[model samples]
Target: MADDFNSQRATLSCFEENKPVFDSFKVNIGKGGLGHGLGEVEFAHSPLEPLKQEGDNKAPIGVFTLDAVFGYEEDIKIKMPYLYATKDLICVDDSESSFYNQILKTPKVMPKSFEEMRRDDAQYELGIVVGHNKEQIRKAGSCIFLHVESSEDAPTAGCTSMKLEDIQKIVSWLDKSKNPILIQITKSQKDEVLKLYPMLKLEE
Candidate 1:
């Protein structure tokens, strides 16, 4: 097991130079859970306030894809996060509302983009591209990206949030030759990613 772990770690380590393939991955986090470099994508970026199909604060979970990109006007061909932004996107809910609890597509503009809904929170102004397809993960919730937060006073509606510069760095790094996709997440979840990937193991 130790040898296997080490080998895995080495393989992933090699990916480090690969540019954009995240060094680690997972789905979990808590308050004060933050990281600078790439990491495991979390199930929920901001679970403090969820969309109201009536009224409920439920964070999304489960495996998903790193689909298309957003925000950036000009498309810069990269491995992943091709011009994606936290402007608008997320796996809609399942309860099936006229609007709530459903995977929505981009340009859901005017009709309350992710930024407007979380305006009160600091993570707004950012948008996430929903990764999960109801048919794929079969999970009961949504999954999306994390980019440009509104600020630091509150949590996101359920999407992750990062800085514009970091987003640009991340986008540029992601190339098909490497990770091919970008996964957003926090610390608590990063541990689990270490266990699954082994390549993320640390000496300390």
Candidate 2:
């Protein structure tokens, strides 16, 4: 565990390669200052190709800050910020839109090329916003999130997806004070991260 990981919780998803589906696990660092495994979790990504532009169906590779626990149900208890996703919720991905890569709050109308957070498939029933191209870089990527997987074998359109139960456990355990982060580095990049954050461990 890194000393700099002041947070009480973190989710580490390691990839042997950017193969779309990878082994993932969560860590809970309590007052004792030691990490305990929450359990094993699996995530899916797009198989089309490596993540690049919008709609590539590939997940981005890098460390990302987790923001906003959102779901259709308003009763989900979490220590972090929460938003009850409604039909009005939209994640604008349009390159021309000034709000690219950001979720609009209570929009009266949907923006062009935006994802409806509230969907009939229930995939967005519970999710966390992933900070990939979050600075609103036009067409870099958008609507990245950690949400419910459509199927165990199916891949995501770019975001990371997992079992609903697994996601609920991870989200409910998150603590805002700890500033939990999601590390999505490839196996090759693992060595570099270890050199910088010696206390951190990347599992394959």
Candidate 3:
């Protein structure tokens, strides 16, 4: 109910420098693997997406942040304590979850509770957090992230998907000063977003 995120009809360029920043992105809504921009990715960033399955078809347009990180110590080292396989976790604001992406107020970490959630597996393997709290964008919510893709061909949920090598490369290069990974929509949505939040417009 709390939707504080920027919509596609609001902005254009979402980068701070004229560099080859963002690794890869989705265009042509609902397209997986790859897509070409109608004109160009005016913005250097991208937006968070809704949860997705391998064959599902839908691509949302909204601005988002890679708020925090999570995963393994040997591989994905999210700076925060958003550990998976623990009992005290939940993806609170999700329509996909019968639990709706919300972790229970009661704290108890259990992996069995998540036995049926293979879609959420990506959150653990990769250290990419998402902006799924459409209920509010401050990020005070539940389970979400851009974890390492299960299969290179695996479709993503709202969160952006990338390879382990890609994630590691991007994370290392990303300016911690820019803590959040900005996911901008394509040209049409970019323009639409700019119309709404003129102040947040990205500079080309």
TM-score of 1: 0.47
Superposed Cα deviation of residue 142, candidate 3 (Å)? 7.6
Candidate that scores best on lDDT = 2
Name the best candidate (by TM-score): 2
| lDDT values, one for every candidate | 0.37, 0.62, 0.41
User: Per-residue lDDT for 44-150 in model 1, tens only?
Assistant: 33455222121122223333345545554444565655443333434334334344334345443323322222234433233345453334332233434455645
Q: List TM-score per model, in order.
A: 0.47, 0.73, 0.50
* CA deviation > 4 Å runs, candidate 2: 1-51, 106-110
Which residue ranges in model 3 land beyond 4 Å of their true spot?
A: 1-18, 22-59, 74-88, 93-123, 134-144, 193-204
Between candidates 2 and 3, name the one with more favorable lDDT.
2
| lDDT of model number 1 | 0.37
Cα RMSD, model 1: 9.8
Write down the RMSD of all candidates, one decimal each: 9.8, 11.3, 9.5
Model 3 / residue 137 / CA error / Å: 10
Query: How does candidate 3 score on lDDT?
Result: 0.41
